[model samples]
Target: MSSIVEIKLSADQTEGTKATVAQWLKRKGEHVTINEPIIELETDKVMMEVIAPVSGVLEDIFVREGEPAEENIILGTILETAMSNPSNEQKNDREIRAEETPKNVSNDLPRKNPAAGQPDPPSTFISPAVRRLRQQHQFDLSQITGTGKNNRITTRDVNAYLSGSMDQSAAQNATYDAAAISPTAAGSEIIPHSQMRKIIADHMQHSVQTAPHVTSIFDLDLSAIIKHRKSNKQAFAQQGAKLTFTAYFMAAAIQAIKHQPKINSQFHEHGLEVFKHVNLGFGTALGDEGLIVPVIQQCQNLNLIQIAQELTRLTDKARNNQLTQKEVQGGTFTLSNHGVSGSLVATPIIINQPQSAILGLGKMEKRVVVEEHNGQDMMVIKPMCYVSLTIDHRALDAYQTNDFLSHFKAVIENWQ
Candidate 1:
């Protein structure tokens, strides 16, 4: 006898946030092997694959492509059939991408109920793909009964409508026509925003709208830390550490944050939320795909050597797209070492919202400066860089910002 196995996105999987169905890898009636990836879900931070739980033929697709997938919903189903020697199933393109997926990205959304005490407002999911299908066919989607969450119209509904399988009801539901948007000119190339880029843009825009931003700049001499790195680099390399300037900057940040604890805080209407641990996040550029901030947790407990080791590991993961959901979250503070890209200084680097501040490092270059030697003026060449701290004005001011910068400078300049 054949049995049916339902594919469900568990509550813990979604983490109280919606994941868009980026694509459906298996079609209805297609055979699927156990532990095979059959779907891709696009979350705010990563792309995850939902794996098949049993060996069988896909019987149905409950959530179509380009629809919001919610917790406790059946994504699809498989008709389970008896298998012989299933263990010998060779890995194929259908193999589980467990290393890259099975991830649950963290969010500030409420754990129990995202709505909290207030009732949620009415909203519907009308996807870009569905609208484009409508634009191409001139079919009003209201003619079909929706099977998606909250009775939202989905791509499957449009398909049924097109195939004359749905009611012929007619009415234009004014849904900002995502399909009607045209290009700037006839031949201009248009690349749709990647899921990561789209969410990042929303995050940035939201940060700007929610926070009153202010920036403070300071110039620091890197001679001491540069000397320290050069002296210990070989030893660090022997111990599997990279001895990067980023490691030094992060160590300095920890010292400064310890001296000025208020700098490691998040803003709230009730009060300022100060954290005891320094969980640092740094921007890792992914070239054309945009950058992702992979956080290193509990820096207050780690030494310089340990920090360097972790920096090597996480940075490798970020660049190769191997970072886990947990590896990219729980950051109480952020740093942007934009200097490596040859930027002299970047003012007002956008604050990672909810967090009060973000630190910016400028390019290091040799510059001439005047120094007093035995009551005589002398010119000396030194390596220097401009450091900037951008803070939310509501949670911090020039006084505190300067204090943090001062301590940061002291740590870097006097490193032993």
Candidate 2:
């Protein structure tokens, strides 16, 4: 008799209420190594993989693809065995079934294997989240190609297809009827909101309702910082850190926070809870999915280079979906660099709950401005960017906000 080890969903998988089985990398009777990833769980925040606890052969899978799996539930079992081979009879049966299944099941549904003219397995091989998106868009799987490992269709691939198709249709029709393009039309889909999207919506709505929001905008001259970067960028690159304007902004923000601790505080019933150490959270956009704020804890202790390195690491992890629960939590202040996407400005960016203020950086551009040079007014070209600070009025006053921004502006302008 083989000893069986249960594979349970770990508590640290996510902070969301539930997670859906995104995919199963291993099948029943397949041999798996200890600590090897066997399954992926899609939570409201991110997609995480579950690893096998002990070396064994996968014996049973209780959670199928696209099914809701609660935390600590046994997802599957692994039998103590090293055998990798499947039974000859089972293989023959699988082959026969593959041959018998239709290549395309329905025009509205995705095809199993359009190129091979064979139907996909009965399971559809798509996560519930991706399947919901496909249905909502009324997409035919045969039309879109999968880019994931082993040609699995990912949510990103489906989003790209939708974007391209919409653009093409709009161009062809010029003034397309809005009703005709609605997903509720015939052959269209109405997808229920995913858990992650719902949570985000609720949080945002609660934030707007809870705080008395106020925004103050300022135009920043980046001449000194730009010149500094041009001079030392090569040196910074040699030290494995790419010198970017964000680092300068981060450093300036830290200095401002130090000067005004109230900017890094939260309002409570008892009193104001001001934090001594700045836990800076930077927003990273994940296309089609949503945004995530990964924090660099104790940011006040890090220098410019260290801040840059930490930001790079967190950003890379966020984009690659490798951030842990801890990395996304406990932020004292938030920054959204919306300028990266070419936006000019975004006012009154909602404060991340419990955090008093949020900063938004707009696009940087060169413009001609009149300046007093050598006791005379002179016109010169300079790089300028707009920075907006949105604060919870209850926790921060306009005077404090202005003071913080003044300090921040001075730091950048007088960068050594």
**Best by TM-score, which number?**
1
Encode model 1's per-residue lDDT on 1-416: one tens digit a residue.
Answer: 78999998887664443478887766676667787667767666555668799997888999987787887788889988776533322232124322212123222233346657654322133444555676676765546565433343445446545645433332122222345545679876344665567767777888889888888899989999988888999999999999999999999999999999989999999999999999999998877667788889999979999999999999987765556666766789999999999999997455357889999999999999899999999999999999999998889988999999999999999999
User: All candidates: CA RMSD in angstroms?
Assistant: 14.5, 9.1
Model 1's TM-score against the true structure: 0.68
Residue-by-residue lDDT tens digits, candidate 2, 201-233: 766888889998999999899999999989988
Q: Which ten residues in a row have the lowest lDDT in candidate 1?
A: 98-107
Per-candidate clashes come to 0, 1
- CA lDDT of every candidate: 0.76, 0.76
Please list the residue runs of candidate 2 whose C-alpha ends up more than 4 Å from where it truly belongs after superposition: 1-41, 49-196, 373-376
Query: Compared to the true structure, candidate 2 yields what TM-score?
Result: 0.65
Candidate 1 segments exceeding 4 Å error: 1-19, 28-38, 51-63, 68-183, 186-188, 348-351, 373-378
